[model samples]
Target chain A: MRALDVDYMLGLLPILLGYVPLTLFMAVVGMAFALVLAALMAVERVVRIPVLDIFVRLFISFFRGTPLLVQLFLFYFGLPQMLSFLTTINGVTATIMGLTLHFSAYMAESIRAAILGVDRAQWEASLAVGMTQAQMMRRIILPQAARVAAPTLVNYFIDMVKSTSLAFTLGVTELMGAAQKEAAGSFLYFEAFLVVATIYWIMVEALSFGQRRLETFLNKAHAR
Target chain B: MISVQNLNKSFGATPVLQDISLDIQPGERVVVIGPSGTGKSTLLRCLNFLDTPDSGKITIGDLSVDAAHASRADILGLRRRTGFVFQNYALFANKTARQNITEALVTVKGMSRADADARADTILRETGLEARADAYPASLSGGQQQRVGIGRAMALDAELLLFDEPTSALDPEWVGEVLDLMRKLAESRQTMLIVTHEMQFAREIADRILFMDDGRIAEEGPPADLLDTPRDPRTRAFLRRVG
Candidate 1:
């Protein structure tokens, strides 16, 4: 509104950069948790393990069908009131939990499709060779599924980094939080928000570049 | 020896294999020829417990499993004694030809890496896939991939090999190479149950050719008798069309 404060935007860039590590940490850690949980859910869905399959389906449907912000509040605000042990949950913990559960719901579908994408013959061949179900999954299915799911997972991770901005609503002073506080102090909301957006854009662009390189590397053997 | 008793399998209401029973003496090369959808592949799959039977008994070596009571351990044990080569060459896409051969050796057989690598090398040489050892399935031609599939199966040294239409997916040019390798295995007296459309190859290599129809063995005997002499009308009709 007040002439778009270019100088203020330039000055605030480094200050915001200071929070990049924490932002990256939340996204990375959230992704790690999400990857493991998603794989289990995907496998369960594929294997269709009696009652457990239905439970996993419901969890995935609920988390995936709902918004990340509501899930965060459910973890941070609603969960503690429902369970005494969850009283230990705080802003950062709540953010991580929300990110993990919410994103896992989406990632599970991707991983499941990837697992199914592997030729059916591979499973029969692995079984014929006397591989246990666990062995088949570890040595064959999961590895191939990882290759198929990698690009999509990387995209999710980039979205996750941007999604950490929502964590500011939970009282964690991550990058966006830092930006908000700076804007409040300097009364230059436009410039502060613009600086934060630019940083996020650069980070996403770098990840996109890495995604291409990784895809090329993964597909090199198949490339004629 | 392998013995199957009263093996029955169905998909929903449609019967794929009905009360099928047979025996294979050690080192007997049994080739099964039948029309598509007649359950020839299903029969081979059931022997290895790949397609769990609705009601049956399968015994390979000392391991035996019955359809009604087959446990996971029993299925695993039976599978350990047999190898399967899929029509599409089912070599692991992520692994190299050598690794595909070595995977079962190291993981299922619990062989040390050195031993597995040695076994893989021997099999690769046997299948004439040595030059393609490091190549992945997608990079190799169909013949080479199927050779890798056979090598992977042979590396396990399973008591029996079950081949489900091994050459069906190959191009015409590649089919002969695969048939030649299979001929070599037969010459070495590897016990095998093969389902194939290559009637000529079946006639040459089979100790007994089982002509299947409607999920049952319509006729079976010495390869020469089955191929040359008159038999069941169904068998005659099938041979007339394919031979």
Candidate 2:
């Protein structure tokens, strides 16, 4: 029987902690990029502009239909070969690109649903009040949609944090990759994984708590 | 003033309004009443080009708002001059009552934030929602939400206000408050075209009454003559059923 060693787990703690900032950077940057792109996609879909809507629909379908892992490979491996400029792209950039593309597809749908959930009469009401389409979108539609999309966007961000584990495949050496390397070197797989899992659990729990608070605040504002 | 000539509208093969003609003088208060499927709402919607008429001419002041003749910019201009209050209130769910009223003033009217805030505060207070100005639509009663809706339209200082069943969604007890607000608005001599089921309010307040049936105006006249002695049998039957 293999004895459990508290010392081995303690030794791995700093190593995992060292990679925490990288994980957070990846998640935050990826989410910001995804949300901006998602907002554009949502607006395009809602207006149903000529020819552009079809292109957006195809783009959303392609990204959402494929698995994230395969998409990562396609962007990191396939794109570099197809476009020489992309060949110089670094591992972190490639991982972020993949994360943004995959998550924005899902985020776009969430935002689109939120926009559509606003009553049809609101559009008429805005027009009746003399607002141009652009003004209405900026002042009325987007603010309301943000409230509807807030919780869902937070969920995607949490998923994005967990999905950062996949960044190891692109050679970014985030927390998960660091844990994998530590396990390989020390030959204590259980100890390394257990420590990494605890870090992830704590981070996710903190984000979820923050999300709940935001949701409650938004709900109160809505009730007002 | 608004005028319509040979207005036509349809949904695919199902015609909702056909060859309708009407004219509304400045400061006129016209009430349109009809059964569920009649084109009363469609007619009101077309006045501001909310729904484009298939073939027709709608002129408000100097602006011509025919779908075939007008540019998108012209349509938007016409819409700005004509305020519309929907049956559902249509308050932006995320905004407070004051924000909802001020949004257009700031965004479209190019009013300063401070000025808009002051105007919205005054309007909200006048609507009897001063205490609930910061409240959201979900928190307010149906009557309150409708009042906010009226305040929103009024904030635009539009030339004409269109009401499409403003009190239809309110609870029975709450309906009177909204009707009372409408009556007060009428007293201000605002130009209005209202589609309503409240016969008493229409009888007491409308300068002219239009009774629509099956995509056409079955009858129209002053409220006194129309409600008491409608020219069309269809109008008489409708008033009988609703009243």
Against the native complex, each candidate's DockQ, computed on alpha carbons, is 0.72, 0.64
lDDT accuracy of residue A97 in candidate 2: 90
lDDT of 1 by residue, B1-243 (tens): 899999999988999998888999999999998888999999988887888889999889998888879998998998999989999888888899899999988898899999999888888888888888998788999999999898888888889999999999899999999999999999999999999999889888999999888988888998899888847888888888985
Model 2: per-residue lDDT, tens digit, A1-224? 79987899998899789999999998999999999999999989999999999999998999999999999988888998999999898878888898999999999999999999877777777777777888778777887788799999999999999998998998878999999998899999998999999999999999999998988887775653
TM-score of 2: 0.93
With a 3 Å backbone cut-off (N, CA, C), the pairs that clash in candidate 1 are none
lDDT of 1 by residue, A2-67 (tens): 477788888898899999999998999999999999999999988899999989999999998999
Q: How close is every model to the real structure, measured as TM-score? A: 0.95, 0.93
**Model 1 deviation from native, Cα RMSD in Å:** 1.9
